[model samples]
Target: MAKVSISLDAELVVEVMVLAGIGSPQDAIEAVVRDYVVRGHRTEARTELKDRNLREVDAKPQEPQG
Candidate 1:
């Protein structure tokens, strides 16, 4: 783990703490950063699928009775 020193607005920190349901400022910041990274990954994946003209298929197995 890397330790970083950052300056943030007190109000913003409070808001992030509330939204993330975390009391530690570090946890709140890490949560926000992780969410941001995941969102970027999802966006990239969607764009790649769109470029390939690919759509997700729903393939449900049907039960056959004699």
Candidate 2:
């Protein structure tokens, strides 16, 4: 993995460390970012499937079963 150096507020980093229960600021930030990305991917997957299913069902003609 490539490492990049960026500046962030000390107070914000401390908050993230506390919330994530991670002693290292870098680890805490990385964990939080990874979690956010995972959640976004999961949400996109679920919604994309749901939308496609709805459109497919609506486009098809349903016959009444006797």
Q: Which candidate number maximizes lDDT?
A: 2
Taking all chains together, each candidate's TM-score versus the true structure is: 0.72, 0.85
Tens-digit per-residue lDDT, 1-66, candidate 2: 889999999999999999999999999999999999999999999999999999999999999889
TM-score, prediction 2 = 0.85
RMSD in angstroms, all models? Answer: 9.3, 3.4
Against the hidden true structure, what lDDT does model 1 obtain? 0.88
Candidate 2 lDDT: 0.98
Task: Give lDDT: candidate 2, residue 22.
Answer: 100
Clashing pairs in 2: none
Cα lDDT, model 2, residue 1: 88
Q: How much RMSD separates candidate 2 from the native structure? A: 3.4
Report lDDT (Cα) of residue 62, candidate 1.
52
Please report the TM-score between candidate 1 and the true structure: 0.72
- Estimate every model's Cα lDDT from 0 to 1: 0.88, 0.98
Mark the 10 consecutive residues where model 1 has the least summed lDDT. 53-62
Write the residue-wise lDDT of candidate 1 on 1-66 in tens digits.
978899999999999999889999989999999999999999999999886664333344558879
Model 1 segments more than 4 A misplaced: 54-66
